[model samples]
Target: MRTALLLAAFLCGPALADRQSFPPVDEADRDPSLVEFRETLLAKIAARDVDTIVALACPDIYLSHGGDGGPEELRANLVLDPQTLSEEYREDADAMREQYWTDLENTLSQPGYFDDEGEFWMPHQWQITLPASLDAHLAYFVTGQNVSLRQQPNRDAPLITRISHEVVILRDHQSSAEYQRVLLTDGTQGYMHSDFLWPMTGHRAAFVKSDAGGWQLCTFVSGD
Candidate 1:
């Protein structure tokens, strides 16, 4: 029995260690200045005040992994002029622009934390560091408590477990499907509602304090 127990522990130890939960915490209120700045920026974004929004960004804001990230690129991305696209793709220009705006607004609205450099990063989950061996594209965070892990893709399926603020491996994600197939770190496989799963590579933004003691949008990009 002792030998059997030891073997079991050895088999499960690494998997258990890989399972970690990173709950969201909002630290924006820690700095009154940041809180006020964020509120004003959010309002401007909602109103699509292009000039004011561009003015709030750093002179060389980082908007993507590869690109000349400056106010010009930011403006182009925000405006998404249909005239610039091929005639075939022009019909969806409005949707593309709206998506970019929505992504920015939603990301900033999420709870955020202050990094070591004193920069504030949003959507709280952006701070999580996954195991290097894990495939980043396959990992997702459960954003809710007692979120059901169903035995099948449908709600009426048997309950496998309830996950809360934990990392789960996604086997597959269908954008139109309501439930996503997922695998728990313990080797249990199930389906979870799509709404509660946030991809680790999802959009995240950062705000930095300028030399004049004002906050500016510094980074707003997604992916690894």
Candidate 2:
């Protein structure tokens, strides 16, 4: 008897599915290494912590994902020329199953690539160290949807900081509204929205820019 082999490929971008190969990043993805304490970053974004989110990303970070038409396609979905999504999309269990199966079928039908688990890299911690004079903390920014930044500690920049999802900075201080602020990375602080920011786990020291953009040590919020 001949048996058909089922090969699965995971696609990036917003296409949702259940057996769709790569599982969507859930609460687990935000733990320990990624960046902010999952909840606090959420609070910051709900609060609109603009300055905080931007401070956490690496400089030269550009967004990409599978399923996207391309980079520009994803950017069009994220970059807010006017507005952003207000609530998280909670897929109905049955609907998710249907989408998952459909995507899974499409993925399995394609020729599979050899993925060596050992060759794959999983980040234990994502960090962002601002220039000596910037006053702020670091975080993870998810590009595409809204700028979802998870605030955390420092890491080397000028490299692609792989995350489960693409993110951007939150520059506000309130704990409920997604604040607006400048993200200090890639040698410049770009403007980002507040909705997408989340807090990384554990507290780390940070700096704030003086009137002259000089770093002065600052205190981290309790959950920061």
Q: Top lDDT: which candidate number?
A: 1
Q: List the candidate 2 regions with Cα displacement exceeding 4 Å.
A: 1-137, 143-172, 202-224
* lDDT for residue 71 in candidate 2, whole number 0-100: 29
- Candidate 2 C-alpha error for residue 177, in Å: 3.2
Residues 134-172 of candidate 1: C-alpha lDDT, one tens digit per residue? 667877879898999998999999998899888777756
- Candidate 1 regions exceeding 4 Å error are 1-18
**Each prediction's Cα lDDT score?**
0.84, 0.30
Clashes of each: 0, 59
lDDT of 2 by residue, 118-161 (tens): 11111112232222332224343332232322232222223222
Name the lDDT value of residue 111 in candidate 2: 20
Candidate 1 residue 111 Cα shift, in angstroms, is 0.9
Q: Which ten residues in a row have the lowest lDDT in candidate 1?
A: 1-10
Residue 199's lDDT within candidate 2 is 39
